[model samples]
Target: MDIFSNHKRLFLLVILLFGTLTVFVAIFPALNNQYSYEPLPDSIPLTEIEQRGKMVYIGNGCVACHTQQVRNVEIDKVWGSRPNVAADYAGIERTNFWVNTATLMGTERTGPDLTNIGKRQPSEDWHLTHLYQPRAVVENSVMAPYPWLFELKDSIKITEKDKIVNLPARYIKDKSKKVVATEDAIALVAYLKSLQQVKLPDGTPSPEFLYKREQKKHGANESGGSSALDGAELYTNYCASCHQTDGKGVSGAFPPLDGSAIVQGIDPTSMVNIIMYGYNAREEYGEMPAIGQINDLSLEELVALMNHERTSWSNDAPEVSLEEINKILEELKKQNENQ
Candidate 1:
C-alpha cells in the first residue's frame, strides 16, 4: 500500500510482463507449427527464377482467383490427392532474413486450386498460351491476358523455344508480329511449376476420394444405357467446365463439341489426339488443354468421352474402341519422338 516503497519492485514486474508477451507473440507460432512438420518425398527448394516468379504471381493478384490451400472436404478431389498439410510448404525459402511470404493459402477459389498445379498441369506450353490470352485456352475465362509477357508472332527469326505459345488464329492482332516469350513469362511459369504439394509423411494415410467418387459419378443421359461410368463421369468432372454440359461451348471462347466436325469426323484418331495433346487450330476459338493426358484418363475413359460426345446433340459417330484409342495415342507418341 506504500506507493513509493515498491517503485523498484513495480519496474521489475513490468519488464517481466513485456518479455513474456514478446516470447508468446514470436516463439509460439514456430513451436505450434513444429508438430505439423513432416518431410515430404521429392521436395525441392525454389531456384532464383522460381523465387522471382513467386513475386510476379503475388504482384499479379493470382491469389485473388486461385487458392493455394487444398481443403480436407470430399468435394476437393479435383485439386489434389490429399488435403494441404504444413509440411507441404515446409521447404518454402525465406524471402529476407526473417520473412517467409510463400504461404498465401487463400480462401477464395474463383479459379481452380493451385496447390498441386505443378503436378496436375505441368506443361509450360499450356501455361504460356493460357497466360497470353486466358480466353485463348479457357473459354469463358475471365482472367486477364498478360500480352506484355509475349511478343507478336513473325516467321522471319523465331525458333520453337522462343515462340512457346500457339495461340488460336482469331486472337492475332498482327500476323507479322510473332509472339516471343519474355523473361517474366518464363519466371511466372517456373513459379507456377513449383506450386505443388508433396506426398504426406509415412504413417499418414492418403486421402481416399473413392467414397465420394461413386456418388459423383456423372452421366444420366436422355438416352441412358449400361455403359462405362468412368468416361461420362470423368468428362463431367474434368472437361465439362470449359466445354459445357451440352457441348455447345461458349461463343468466341471454346469450340463447339455438340455437332463439331472434329467430333463427328470419320477418323477418331484426330479427336483422340486432340484430347490427349491439346489444340490451337483456330485463333478465334480458345485453346484446348490436353484434358485426357493431364487428367490421366484411361484408354477406355477417353473412348467413353469420345463416344458420349459423338452420340449426344444428334450427332452420332461410330463408337470408338479402346483398341483404336490406344493406336492413335501410340502413333502420336512416335510422331512426337520423331519431331
Candidate 2:
C-alpha cells in the first residue's frame, strides 16, 4: 500500500515538472523571440501625442492584422528586406513610462507586415489621407478607416461678457451636433509615426533611389524612341507573366519594377550587369535566368528595351546608352569564359 501511494505522488510531480519545462522552453521562445523587433538607428523621438496614439493602437487591436517582422529569404524577397531583430524594440524602453511597453514582438502575420511602414511612406499627410479612406489612396488597401479619430468642431463663438454658449453649427455636426476628434484617434496616429525602420549607416540607399521610377519620365518628350519601345515589347513578352503587365507584381514573389527605385534609380551599369550576367544571390528571388542567351537582342536593342521599361508605363527613368550595354556584354563574356 505504501509503495503504491509513493508511485502516485511521483507521477504527479513528473507531470508538473514536464509542464513547467514546456512552458519555459517551448512556449516562451515561440511567443517572445519568433519575430524579434529591431529599432532603426537615428530614429526621431516620439512626441507625447505619438505615445498616446500607441495606446489607441493597443486598444483597437491593430496588431491583430499587421505583423512587425520581415524574414530574410522566403519572405524578404516579397517584402524587400530581412526580418527584424531584437534591437528594433529598444526604442520602446526610452518612451513608455508604463509597464506594458509598446513592443510588437509577435510571430503571425495575418495581414501585410508593418516592419518598415514609416520608410515605405514618409508623408504624414499621406498617412492622414490614408486613414481617412484607404481606398482613396490605394485602390486595393484592405484597411478600414477610423473616422472617429479626427476632431470635428463647430465655429468658435465669443460673447461680449466673455461667456460663450450655443456654438455655431460649423463647430459641430450639421445634423447631429456631435463633435468628433476623439483622443484615441490622435494617439493612434502618434503610434503609427513611431513605427519607422532603422537604417544602417552605410547600407541605406540614397533619397534618389527612393523615388518611384514612374516619376522620372516627366522631363523627356521624344515619343518614337525605338529602344524603349522594343524593351517594353520584350518585357511584355518575357517578363509580364511573373512581373504582371502593369508591373505591380504579385505580392510575396516578383517585386514591382514599374515603380521600383532599385530598377530605375540604381546605376545603369548595375542594371545592365543584372540583365546580362543574371543574379543568383540568395538575397533576391530564384535566380533570374540568363535570358540574354536565348533572346539574341543586340547591345543597342537591349539598352533600348531596358530604358523603355524604365521609363514606360508609369515609370520615368532616364534612357540607357548602348555603350553601357556593350560594356555589360563584355563583362558577361569575361565572366562566362572564367566559369
Candidate 3:
C-alpha cells in the first residue's frame, strides 16, 4: 500500500524494468557474437552506377507500382526461382548507424513483383524502351512513360557517348528526330538490373531447396525435349511473358497475333522473315525482336508457331510447308539484291 502510494518508487521500478528489458532483449541479442556463426556471404554488391540508379528508382516511385518481396506462396511462383528470404536483401547496407533508406520492400504490387526481374528480363533495350513508352513494349501497359529521361536527336551528329534508342519509324515520324537515352534512364535501368536475388548465405535452412527444384525442372526439360512441347506450351513458356496468352496483345504495345493479317496472309515470306530477322515500327509498335534466331528454334518449331498463330481465334489461313517458307526467304533476298 505504501509503495503504491509512492510516486518516486513506482517511477524507479518502471525505469529499472524497462531498462533491463532494453538491454537483455535488444542490446544483448545485437551483441551476441554466436548469432553470426554463419559467415558473411560472397554475394556481389551493386556498382556505384547501380546505386545511383537505385536513387532514381526511388525518386520515380517505382516501388509504388512494383514489389521487391516475393512471398512464400503458390501464386508468387512467377516472381522468382524460390520464395524470398531475408538474405535476398542482406546486401542493402545502412545509410548510417541510425538511418537505413534501402529497405525498398514495398507494400503493394500495382505491377509485377521485381524480386528477380534482373535475371528474367536482361535486355537493356527492352527495359529502356519500356521506360520510354511502356505501352510500346507491353501493349496495354498502364505505366506512365518517363519521356523526360530521354532527349530527342534533331539531325545532330551522333557522338560515341550518345545512347541512341532504336524506335519505330512511326514513333519517330519526324526523320530529323531520333531518341537518345539519358543518364538517369541508364542509371535507373542499371538499378533495375541490380534488383536480383542473391544466392542464399551458406548454412541457411533449406538453402538449396529452390535451386534443386529448378535443376530438376531443367533435367526434365532436357529429357522430354523442346520438340515434344507443342506450340501452345512453348508460347506459354517463352512468348507469354510479352505477347500474352490471348494473343490480343498488350493493347498498344504488342500487336495482336490472333487477328493479324501477317499471320493469316497468303504469302508466308514476311512472317518467316519476321521470325528470322524480327521487325521495326509497322505503326505504333516499337520493335519485335528476332526471338526465333535468338532461341535457335527449329524449322519444325517455326512451322508449329506460325500454324498456331494463323489458326487461332477466327483466323483460317492455309498452312505453308517448310520448303515453301525457305523458297520465299531466298526470293526475298534476291529482290533485296535487285533493289
Candidate 4:
C-alpha cells in the first residue's frame, strides 16, 4: 500500500502486469499454434520457386482481395473440398526476422478463394493469360491486369526457351507481337498451381460442410434420375473458369464445349472418359485434367455434369442416366485393372 504512493514503484508494478498479460494473451498462444499443429501427412511443403511466388503474392497485394481460407459453411464448399484446418497452415513459416509469412489467410473474398484452385484450374496457359489480363479469361473481371509481369516479344527465338502466353486477338494491342510471362508471373502461377488441398489419410472420414442448403432436384431430367446437386451451380464452380458460361471455351486455350459432337453425341463414352481420365490437347489447347476423378465426383454429380454439358448452350443432346455413367466408370475401372 505504501509502495502505491511511490510513482517509481507503481510504474514498475504496472509494467510487470502488462508484461504478464502480453505473455498469456499474445506470446503463449502464438507459440502454441506454431508448435502444436502439424501439416497434414499428405500435404507437401512449398518448393523454392513456390516460396518465391508466395513472396510475390504478398508483394502484389493479392491477399487484399483473394482469400486462402474456406469456411466450414456449405456456401464455402465450392471453394474447397473441406473447411480450413489448423494443419493446412501448419507448415507456413515466417519470411525472415521481421515478416510473419505463417498465414496468408486473406480477409476479404473479393476474388474467389485459392484454397483448391490448383485442382480446379490447373492449366498453366489459363493462369498466365489470366495474370496478363484477367478479362482475357474472365470477362467483366475487376481485378487489375499484371501487364508488368509479362513481356511482349516480337517472335519466339529458336534457341531461347520462352513459354509464350496464349492471348486472344482482342486483348493483343500489337498483332505482330507475342506475350511471354516473366519469371515473376511464372513463379506466381507455380504458387497458384501448388494450392491444391491434400486428401485425408485413407479410411479417415472428411469433415462435412455445415448448414447445407436444401434444394429440389432441379438438375433432374426425364431420362436421368434427379440429382440433389445442381448441375448449373456445379458447372459454374468447377468448369466455368475455363469453359466460359456460354459453353464456348477460350480460343487457342480451352476448346469450346458448345456444339461439340462429343458432347451432343448419343454415346457419352468420350465425354465421360474425358471427364474421368482427362485429355491432352496441348498441341492447340491446354491439357484438361481429370477433374471428376480429382474431386472424387459422385455418380449423381457426374450425371448432372454430363446432362448440363449435353443440354447447355447450343448443345441439344440426350441426358445420360446415372446407370450409364456408372457402367462407363465400371468399364474404365476394369480397363485400368487390366492395364
lDDT winner? 4
Q: In candidate 4, where is summed lDDT lowest over 10 consecutive residues?
A: 154-163
Runs in model 1 deviating more than 4 A are 1-18, 25-36, 96-99, 119-123, 153-161, 168-170, 197-203, 208-233, 236-294, 313-315, 321-339
Per-candidate alpha-carbon RMSD to the true structure: 5.3, 15.9, 8.6, 2.8
Count clashing residue pairs in model 3: 3
User: Model 2 Cα displacement at 335 (Å)?
Assistant: 46
Residue 306, model 4: Cα distance from true site in angstroms? 1.1
- Deviation in Å, model 1, residue 125 alpha carbon: 4.0
lDDT of 3 by residue, 24-95 (tens): 998997556335433237557779888889878888999898998877765676676567765556557765
Computed on alpha carbons, the lDDT of every model, listed in order, comes to 0.74, 0.57, 0.70, 0.86
lDDT of 1 by residue, 256-324 (tens): 788888889998778988888888777665466676766677766677778778888778877776666
Error of 2 at 147 (Å): 2.1
The per-residue C-alpha lDDT of model 1 at residue 231 equals: 56
TM-score of each: 0.69, 0.45, 0.60, 0.88
The sequence of per-residue lDDT tens digits that candidate 2 reaches over residues 1-339 is 464579888788889999999999999985675456445567666688887776677667778787776654353433324445556565565343546655664566665666665534333434554565554445577888766666444435322322111222332246343233355654565567567566554775422223223322223324323422356556754465445678775443345677877678757666666665555563333345444543445675576668767886788887766666577678768887999
Order the candidates by lDDT, highest first — what do you get?
Answer: 4, 1, 3, 2
Q: Which ranges of candidate 2 are over 4 A from the true structure?
A: 1-47, 74-80, 90-102, 105-110, 155-183, 201-339
Candidate 4 lDDT for residue 132: 88
* Weakest ten-residue segment in model 1 by summed lDDT: 219-228
In model 4, the clashing pairs are none
| Highest TM-score scorer | 4
Which clashing pairs does model 3 show? 139-250, 139-253, 140-250
